[model samples]
Target: MTDASALRTAILTSVPADPFQTTAPEPRFVYVPRTHVRALDPDNMLVVGARGTGKSFWWQALLSDAARATLQIPSMSRGKLQVGAGWSENTEPDKDTLAGLRRAGADPRQIWRAVLLAQFDSGVDSMDSWKDRVDWVANHPEAVAKLIRSYDDAADADDTRHLLLFDALDRTADEWTERRALLKGLLQLVLDLRSTKAIRAKVFVRPDMIQDPEVLAFVDSSKVVGSRIELTWPRHELYGLLWQYMGNAFQGAATFRRRHSGWKKDETGLFRMPDTLRTNEQVQRDVFAEIAGKAMGTNERRGLPFTWIPTHLADASSIVTPRSFLAALRTAADETNHDSELALDWRSIHSGVRRASEIRVIELGEDFPWTKPAMAALEGLNVPCSRKDLVSRWTANSVMERLDGLPTGDRNKNATLGQQGLLNDLVEVGVLEVRSDGRYNIPDVYRVGFGLKRRGGVRPVT
Candidate 1:
């Protein structure tokens, strides 16, 4: 028992306390300034941004916070269901809850059908349910009528603000058609449900995933795209997070000192952290400079300071998501933890970026099997390929055909689907960028990995 107690203490001692722990009981660092405070308002909002930008954290946080407040929007639970992440409609509590509600006069089938339509359609369906739902919602006047009636009944019961937090609609790993169907269904449902002053649903989504031509046609596109709070960890914020993370990691150490130490004595004797942990300016300088350095290589001169780091080297217009940030940080931390000197070294961080780059390449390579071929072709030409030329020559080709024809003998039928999946996966993962002109390009940091030139253009690579 004594030994067990000692072990537990040691384990607890190693655990780091978070510095940016949300003051409002429920906190999500992603979407910090925007969603944290404003989300609780009665107005229904569409929190749009890039994936990993802290949408889920904020959405869940707000929901949890709402639980503690005066607001009452029916006692419905927030369900975490993303396609491929879980069986959306098959879960027991959800299915049972909806069934129970339906038995109690709620249109469980209709409400659920709308929820599924709003969340899951992504174009690649060979399934009848997908088509049926799309057609039912789009073609039938009855479907909309039924939804409005359901909303009206709920409103009559004083259950007006039915906040459905569609957190991960963009996280679905579905085909384009299914993706399109889901997006279109969401807009249709939104328009139909808006008639009821009582029913309001907030969709937290990634902008890139919603760019389907079909969905865009009906959507106020600008409402989502324009007001989207791009999840970016600017220098100051990123630095603060890093500092807080490290301070927590080193908490309880003899060298650990809080800012308020000796504050009661002398004003000049304020206890700031040691230099080993990053300051606000140092983190910004280091992150940007490191990103820039990776692209510049040994030359060490040229490129935007923001572009210098691998994390932001993809597109200035592109926003970094929380998942990507976590990936980069975990890699950097693993490397930092292993080094004899426990410090956040830029070289170690860059090495972490390279590791992330490799994973990014492999992920993109799988979906758009043409990814590797395109890179190889770029390497052969030693010049940037035009967007038109790339799509026709590579993106249009099947993964098997692309790999079977490669000169490197890296072709594998077993891995062909994996390769094709990579392209779509990378785009979903935000490693590759699809340009407005329909061209695909890799980040400049990744260009070095692929042995290609550093040129700025929107393009795809996984």
Candidate 2:
């Protein structure tokens, strides 16, 4: 198994510190689901899952014409999709700028339409101000539509399609109150984009924003919601992602490929993997069995390795993100030892789980800064604890008393102050897991992140 050591070397060399920032190359992009491929057909929009759900990765990947071509979604093959940004890091003006237009007596919906128009007609940029752009759009609604249509007609004439992408709107405003108007206006604009067949827009919305009742209050929410796809990883898919990476890593290493030769005995003596892996049952069984053997624990009471890793790493929603999965794999590989039963020894895998939990904690802290302080209060408190003890822990750390000081940052714009309500909030975000007995436990994904240890779990290094 010297080649396995080489495989381990390749994995360690490839593991990125921030998995979200890393993009799997075209040949390596096997995690995408066919639903995502269909949703990518310009007209269908998907509200990506909470952070780390491949929202940003897709945004960057689809930006490359080469990547779009690999999509193999027949609709996109005409030519490279002409991508425009309704909201992106490089193009969008800040919240203050949008607020400036709002202050100028500009209707937010109209301003959003103006932004859409600007994407089609670069001439809108020559105008002195956003107000000027707004006025121009106000004066020529048909012209705006006609301009967008013209671009589509040109693309069609050239045998291609045009698509507009919207992502990272959460960056537009810090507070939900400030962000709501911006999103509501943009959502209306997206809903309206449906009328046009040539130019389609893909809006990557956050789940909480779109799911919020107030945000859905007045609009024909169904139209926008209907086009939405949520980013989620099933138990098997998470494992598939692991083998997909290893398979790709194999392609890069000629020596490793020469050594293992091929796992498929009947096929040519060379490794072969698809550009993307969906639910290929054979591939999952062979690749993972090679890495972690068949069973997870001594007598199969602990389940299979393919099942155990993803199951333990899942958040409250039972979703295992690629980020967490990879983190766990990298850690397991790093910690494997002589006494280990499998290539990825079951015992050694816990350290990976532990590290993934820590990274997840930090990421959650970044996503919800206020919740960080609140989560820290219960750091050492073991789970399966009663709500009374939970509240008592918060009270002990003065987190309950400082509820007023905790930043009420929320996706739905509703932050809780009451103890039980706050605990429920933690559960909603996958920070805490609730049990049938009304007791709560923190999943290992978040247990270490929040600095909490289970009653009989691993101790923190301090």
> 271-325 in candidate 2: lDDT tens per residue?
3444333366566666667667777656677677777778777888787777888
Each prediction's Cα lDDT score?
Answer: 0.42, 0.68
In model 1, the worst 10-residue window by lDDT is 80-89
Residue 38, candidate 1: Cα error in Å is: 5.2
Cα misplacement distance, residue 310 of candidate 1 (Å): 6.3
TM-score, every prediction: 0.53, 0.86
How many clashes in each candidate? 33, 1
The CA root-mean-square deviation of candidate 2, after full C-alpha superposition on the true structure, stands at 4.0
Let me know the TM-score candidate 1 reaches against the reference structure.
0.53
Model 1, runs deviating above 4 Å: 1-31, 34-44, 56-160, 170-174, 219-232, 247-313, 316-318, 337-342, 362-373, 376-442, 448-462
Error of 2 at 397 (Å): 2.6
